[model samples]
Target: MTIIRNIFHGFLRAMSSNSKIPIAPVGVRGMRDLDRTKFSLNVILPVLKVREEKLSKISNILKQYFLKLENFKPVQAQDAVTKCVYFNPEKITQWNEFSEKDKSIFQEHNIDHTSFSLQSVQLSYDNFKIDTIFKAVLPENEETVSGFSQIGHIIHLNLREHLHEYRHLIGQVLLDKIKTCKTVVNKSNIIDNTYRNFKMEVVAGTEDYFVTVKENRCNFQFDFSKVYWNPRLGKEHERILSFLNPNDVLFDVFCGVGPFAVPAARRKCTVFANDLNPDSFKWLNHNAKHNKVNMNIFRSYNLDGKDFICDIFQKFVSNICDGTEKLKEGAKIHVTMNLPAMAVEFLKHFNGLLRNKENTVHVEIIAYVYCFAIGDDPASVAKKMVSDNIGRDISTSILDVFNVRNVSPKKEMMRATIRLNDVIFNELQEPPTKKVCV
Candidate 1:
């Protein structure tokens, strides 16, 4: 009886071992995790050695059918033979369909493909799965893929702890696949809890840290590894700028590299931008010039938002209302505290922030505070927290609440646009004003 039981168990183990496994989930929509196969029909057209300069002129002919697989590289310095790869091996008919314009471009540039060689070559790809051109250098388990930051010409990956071993391969793949990415790096320790910068390891490509990028018709250039910059806030910055007019004043208490300030300045709104990071201060000044914003109207400061509000921000408001009464207040002055982690606490400064202590000023001061909250209802959680910190009953005066993005499984980042009540300006008489926000 024991021998029969043992034989049955062995049979069950064999069956389990032979069972087919399920396919792994594709974590991100754009990620390619499969292997790429070599196709024999891949096009390989080598331009004539003498007329290589004409390659660019005729390349558009190829782009009509195939994606560019490889950039031009010197085949031989002596013969001046250069070659570029067109990704399409399947579009051979397009080559025959070439127009006279293409031939004329070839004729004008003296390019000919007479000595071209066509052959099958296995395109080297790191992924083991089929049909994937570029595979992420995944962890040993291949499950978690974190988001990355593209700074200028660099792509910075904040990989999980398990992905360190494959960092180099991943960096190399990114450099090869991302035409604009000259350098790929793995960021360790993340943005410092206090300093807000990361330790970077360059896994592949150039080591240059300086980068240039454009957002909302504004150009920004900065050090990718040293400074803090988030492309995700491009729209948020624009949204705030859209609310302000040319004659208004903007106080970007935590402005990093003028992402918010430069555009506001361009809109003709005088801007007083400040940051705790010196790099951000320098770059903010640089971007102000880079964007051709009027320097006369823009100010950059290296200070914590808490101090900045007390000094530069106060001076800005004082100068704005130096002659004019505080009648048109809320519509004219705007304060943006964007450090989501600390912005809510910064609201305490507004408890007794402004002077003039009137029941209703000409216009009220509008504060846009960004915060991160974790709960089933992030808006209510953040709204309550904002109310408690500022000492005002949020039963009224919370103008607009925006859910920025989901940072994690349960945590969300949000923005609350609140009109400063008279109660916030030194606990004065709370009087009702126009409900409409300009």
Candidate 2:
């Protein structure tokens, strides 16, 4: 009985052993794990070559890697190619390894040898091929590839690591490049040596508002206290200010961070700045005080309402003129709303403000639209104010689409200019004695 039981036990052990699947080796498992989480050195090395054949090899490797990984989606590959490494294929020779020949070629091409760090090398006996990869470290806190600030340059490289780990470093490199290359041609030189150079007062929690460089003995001032204010819009503010007349009553709607309003007021124009953001309103007041600009600024959130124009006009009439005065009686008002996209919708509303029998008012609404050519017609963007306010159609023809800047490799933001004719309301049959600005 004991012999029979031993035989049965042996048979059961054999079946169990046969049923069990073969476990993957540690090296294979490690490679799989690495493949799932990180970019492979094998894939990156070919991209460094910058040749048609090398590019093809890189694409194939990427495809194989994507297939091998359970979850690997290529969000942007072509764009990545343009950004990742800076090398001219025509001048630089293709190198399979960091051999004497490769070093000599690099020297010939003036490629910085110190920047390249060889991370790994693998040999394939079956194919008689060698794989060598290296990483290039950008300058500390620099935001560009190859130390060039061109908008979409790759500054850093990671072999077998997540792309996001080096994104900020890459972005910093790009930003640094932009700052280095950016040249503001001061035609009028308003900010040149003449104006009293004062150290900008540092407001707590507003570091982005001003840039103080002690090396240059210059402090760049930006109106940070108002709505929609960005240091990037400094040129726009200067442009508007340059065109302003001293006695012109400049009205700025959506006056973010007071970029337009502050500059206009500084130019000695009677400026009325209005914004929907409360924080911006506070900043606008603070900036006005900071810049020492004498101006009337209002903070209101309901600028999208249908009755907003009339309400604002009433207040302007009472404050600027006497209480009983009306617009279109004899008022020459230069209306300026930098929110160009929504300016068209406000035209009808502006007409309503000037309709009352108070005074004859001439209103000029400068509409700005940002856009680019789609095919033959330009692709434009404008906020339909009437659609936003009363759910009405305000689809008017685009006057002129002006290209502002390239936002991406294929896309751009442009500004369009539209004009509204002399609008007189039926209620203003008899002009009032006092002229009220709309």
Candidate 3:
């Protein structure tokens, strides 16, 4: 047994050093020597040296076995330290011979255990091998278990080599069924094209709103119409709306599909939503109708090109202030924009918007920085954009940047809030040097 333990340990150590098996034994467990002839010839080996490298192989094999399974990607490997069941010839035979009826009986009883010879053995595989077996049991409610039984052999193989694969398969099977059983409620009929040429679904009794189908972009939803703006200025909308009193004026620069405007209108706040995209402008008007709110939609473009600071200032003066008439004296304007990476660049233009205003207007300029996670530190990509674009104009002291929730897994989208004091400004300078009222 001691010799066998050393041999097993050595084999495992060598394999761990050479391969990328995710599972590794931390401490020595009891080991025993069994007849070398007892090993089954049908055992399939994992070809890949690393766990991630084997993903494609596993996907291909699973696809081959289950034709309906598409886009099968591995997420996380299950821990299999104490879960592995070593088997002798008799136990293997019993598993192989398990009838559909027998499998159903075991499932009906929710049995998760298997009786087999207990021994710790080290397994080795070639790095070039790509595919490994995965196994799962059929549900007890399954009428015809042949489909499951056919895959049982593969499952058994995975169980012997990588118990994590077996566990993953089981979870996948259950999740698939649950997902399939879900009833997709039809909200497509509620789509109204009277205001905009788009599809909208209002999940009844919830503030959640969804917009359908954008080119190179998936359908998106927001929590509130006022703050939960989508595409860019979602978080800013939420913050401004949180503090907005009823009937307050909200201005959204480059507002897409009324994420900020619609919610503000729903809250009975006057909203002026503007966007450069013709489609977005159309959708904004349509979303207002869908939500049964009166939101002013404006089609305006920031001609500033890459110089967002100059562009934003010009847009505010030419379009938002003059064209929309929403930036009136004493009117509190909650300005929302989905360009966090470029928000600071646009701050220098804020002085011009507040200039000549009698009543102190609140300007909430939102800069959404797409991050990997909700609370993760801003990645280099976003920080670089801020530094490259807005570094010279303003320091961090004058800017109010709040992290919004994570919008994507790639950290490509995040929302940051910038609240500006609505102090009256008399002139717009190349460098903004206007006093702001807190």
lDDT, candidate 1, 1-438, per-residue tens: 896557546534533454321212233224323223321122222222333565565666655544333432323243445554433333332222346776666667655455232332232332122213223324334645456778778888887766676667667666766778899888777554654777888888988998898997989998877678877787887888789887787888888888788989999887888889888888899999988999898888898777987777665455544644342343577889888887888887766656563334455578899998899999898899898887667647788889988888889999999886543455544657868978
By lDDT, the candidates rank as: 1, 2, 3
The candidate that achieves the highest TM-score relative to the unseen native structure: 1
Summarize candidate 3's per-residue lDDT along 1-438 as a digit string, tens digits: 898667556545544455422322222212122122222222212211113433353343223222111232223233432222222221222232345665455445343235211233233221101112111122223221122211101111112222222333333332233322211111223213322222322211222233232211122232222221233343445565676666455556656565556666667666555665455655566656655564343323422323333454334534443446444444454556554434445544554444554433234333332222223455434444443443332224235344564444545454434334421143223665789999
Give all TM-scores, in the order shown: 0.67, 0.42, 0.37
For candidate 3, the lDDT comes to 0.37
Candidate 3 Cα outliers beyond 4 Å, as residue runs: 1-240, 295-331, 340-344, 351-399, 405-416, 422-438
In terms of lDDT, the poorest run of 10 residues in model 3 is 149-158
Report the alpha-carbon TM-score of model 2 versus the true structure: 0.42
The CA-based lDDT of model 2 is what?
Answer: 0.38
Residue 128, candidate 3: alpha-carbon lDDT: 9
Q: Give the per-residue lDDT of model 2 (tens digit) for 29-145.
A: 112112211322221112232323344434533243221111222222334333123221222222333457545655554543443321112222111111100022322333322
Model 3: lDDT of residue 336: 63
